[model samples]
Structure formats: structure tokens, C-alpha cells
Target: MSKKVLVVDDDPDVRSFVVTVLEENQYTPLVACDGVEGLEMIQKEKPDLVILDVLMPRGSGIRLYRHLKTDDALKAVPVIMFTGIALRSFLKSQKALEEFKGEKVPEPDIYLEKPVEPQELVDAIKKKI
Candidate 1:
């Protein structure tokens, strides 16, 4: 069966592009506009993998990622953080959040900066799933 990959991003253009790439590569693509909806879909669908973006409205990807990593049931699902945010900045915020929560979660299974080539995204997904 084709793997299901949930893509969470507020940007419509980026979401659409990712969806197309996944479809072309024979993977099923699921989408959510922001982290709020993304979390809902993640629980309901239990996708094989997730592609997430940072800095979304109404629940940032960072919050959702933290929740996933800390949840025993969902922690095994692979996540690829696809964002425009710099790696250093993202790590700093993640560290601060972990400190505040008194919990340390593992980093994403894969971290891909935005403007990722389609082949690169596919390869990452293939590796994770």
C-alpha cells in the first residue's frame, strides 16, 4: 500500500506543491493548513509520516512536534520539518521550549529547509517511511 504522509503548512502554494510531488511519487498526501488542524488529522489518520512547517497560526508546528515526540503512541511516527526557518533559530526555540516543559524530545527524523528540491523531499520520505 502507498504510504500516507500528512503535510502541515499554512502556505497554500507550498502545500500544493508538496501534494503534487507526493502524488507523482506514488505516496498518498494528506494536508492541513495549520498545526491545529494538523494535530487533529494526525490523530485521526495516523499517517505513516509527517511533513511540518514552523511559525503557523493558531498552534505552531513547534508545539505540535513537541506533542508528537512526547506522546508515547505517536512518537514512533517519523516527522520531517520542512521550513524556511534557519536550523540554528529553530533549535534555539526548541531548546527553550523543552527547558520550560521540563522534557526533552528528540529532534525530527529529518529536517529539510524550505525550497527543497522535489527529489530531495521524496528521498527523505523514502528514507523515513
Candidate 2:
């Protein structure tokens, strides 16, 4: 069976591009506009993997990542942080958040900065799933 990959991003163009790439590569693609809807879909669909963006409305991907990593039932699912934010900036913010919460979560299974190449995305999905 084709693997199901849930893509959570607020950008329509990004979502469309990712969906097309997944479809072309023979993976099933699911989409959610923001972290709130993404969380709902994640809980319901239990996708094989998640491709997430950093900033969004309703809830941020950082919050979603925290919830996923801390949840025993969901922690095993692989996540790819696909965002426009630089990795250095993201890690710095993540460290501050962890310090504030007094908890540490593992970094994403893969981190890809946008705009990502189609082959790179497919390779990441394959590696994770």
C-alpha cells in the first residue's frame, strides 16, 4: 500500500506543490491548512509521516511538534520540518521554548528548508516511512 503523508502548511502553493510531488511519486497525500486542523487530521488519519511548516494560523507547527513528541502514542510517527525559517533560527527558538517548558523534545526526523526540491522531498519521505 502507498504510504499516507500528511502535509500541514498554511501556504496553498506549497501544499499544491507537495501534493503533486507525492502523487507523482506514488505516495498518498493528505493536507491540512494549519496546525489545529493538522492535529485533528493527524489524530484521525494516523498518517505514516508528516510534513510540517513552522508558522501558521490557529496553532504553530512548533506547538504541534511538541505535542507529538511528548505523546507516547504519537511519538513514533516521523516528522519532516519543511519551512522557510532557517535551521539555526528554528533551533534557537526551539531551545528557548524547551527551556521555558523545562522539557526537551527530539528534533524532527528531517528538516528541509523551502523551497524544497521534489526529489529531496521524495527521498525524505522514503527514508522516514
Candidate 3:
């Protein structure tokens, strides 16, 4: 079976696009609309890789990454953090975003601005997995 991948973003269109891309690349793609849902998917699905969006409602992707990072079960899962938030571009990244933003959030394993290039996404996945 192909490797499973989880794509988490609040934007439906982005989720659809990412799923399509992963499927086309012969990967099993799972979709989640928000960080809360993403975390649930991670726990339930245990995908080979996770693609997350940082600036999400209710929960933040960066926080989710740290949660996974510290967890013994989820620590081995590779995470790709994509965010449209511009604040990080102007600030320095730390061990976590919550510390840097102080109410904002931290950065993902890798950050991508919106309008993601298809190849960039693929490349990121390939490297992580």
C-alpha cells in the first residue's frame, strides 16, 4: 500500500488540492479542516506524514507539531508545516511558536507561504518521508 499522508488546512480548496496532488503522486491522502481535526486524524490515522497549516482556528498547527514532537507515539511522524501567516517572516523561529508569538504561535518544521507551488509541496513530502 502507498504511504498515508495527512493534509491539514482550514481552507477546503487547499485541502482538496493537496489531497489530489498526493493521490496523483501515489500517496494515500487524508484531509482535515482544522488543527483540532488534524490532531484527531493524527491520533486515529497515524499517517506516514502530516502537512499542517499554522494559522488555524480553535487550535494552531505549530502547537499541534509540538504536541506530536513530545509524544513518544507521535514523535517519529514527519510534519510539514505550511502557513500563510506573515508574522513569522518578520520574526525569528524558536523551539516552538507559542514561545515566540506569546499568544501567537510558533513555526512548523518547514514553512510555506500560500499559493504553494505543486513541486514545492511534493519536494517537501519527499524529503520528510
Candidate 4:
């Protein structure tokens, strides 16, 4: 069976682009508009990988990413931290510090900037799964 991937982003264009790419690559793409919804899908669908955006409404992607990293069951799922924000911002976010304390959360498997390159995104997904 084709591997499943969950894409969580608030922007419609970005989400659509990713979905199209995943479909073309023969991976099943599951989508969510926000982090909370993404988590729900992750728990229910248990996708092989996740593509997450940093800034979002409801629960932010960083928040959800941290949650997944800390959760025993979901920690192993590969996540690509796709964002328009600079890398330093992500490293400096309050959530980042809070989540990494005690038992540190694992860093995102990959980090992709906004306006993601189609081939690069595909390559990252391929490498992760």
C-alpha cells in the first residue's frame, strides 16, 4: 500500500500544492487546516509522515509538533517543519524551549521553507519514508 502523509497548513494554496505533489508521487495525502485537526487525523489515520506549517490558528504547528515528539506513540512519526518563518524564530519560540526541557523533543526530521520546491519536497518525503 502507498504510504500516507498528513499535511497541516492554514494556507489553501500551500496545502493544495503539497497534496497535488504527494498524489503525483503515489503517496496518499491527508490534509488539515490547522494543528488541532492535524493531530486528530494523525491519531486516527496514523500517517507515515507529516508536513507541518509553523504559524497557524488554533493550535500552531510547532505546538502540535512538540506534542507529537513528546507523546510516546506518535514520537516516531517523521515530521517536516515547513514554514515561512526563519529558522532562528523557530528555535527561539517559547513553545520550542518549553517542549525541549527535561526529556528533549527530537528536532524535525527536515525543515523546508515556504514556496517549497516541488522536487525538494518530494525528495525529503522520499528520504524520510
The lDDT values for all models are: 0.94, 0.95, 0.79, 0.91
Q: List RMSD in Å for every model shown.
A: 0.7, 0.6, 3.5, 1.8
State the lDDT of candidate 1 residue by residue for 1-129, as single tens digits. 998999999999999999999999999999999999999999999999999998899899999999899899999999999999988899999899888988999978889998989999999999987
Highest-scoring model, lDDT? 2
Question: What is the C-alpha lDDT profile of model 2 across 62-116, one tens digit per residue?
Answer: 9999999999999999999999999999999999999999999998889999987
lDDT of 4 at 99: 55
For each candidate, what TM-score against the reference?
0.98, 0.98, 0.82, 0.93
Poorest lDDT segment (10 consecutive residues) of candidate 3: 87-96
> Residue 40 deviation, candidate 4, in Å?
0.3
Once fitted onto the true fold, the runs of candidate 4 whose alpha carbons sit more than 4 angstroms away are: 94-96, 99-103
Clashes of each: 0, 0, 3, 0
TM-score for candidate 1: 0.98
**What is candidate 3's lDDT per residue for 5-49, written digit by digit as tens?**
999899888988899889889999999888889889999999999
Clashing pairs for predicted structure model 1, backbone only: none
> What residue pairs are clashing in model 4?
none
Candidate 1 ranges beyond 4 A from true positions? none
RMSD of 3: 3.5
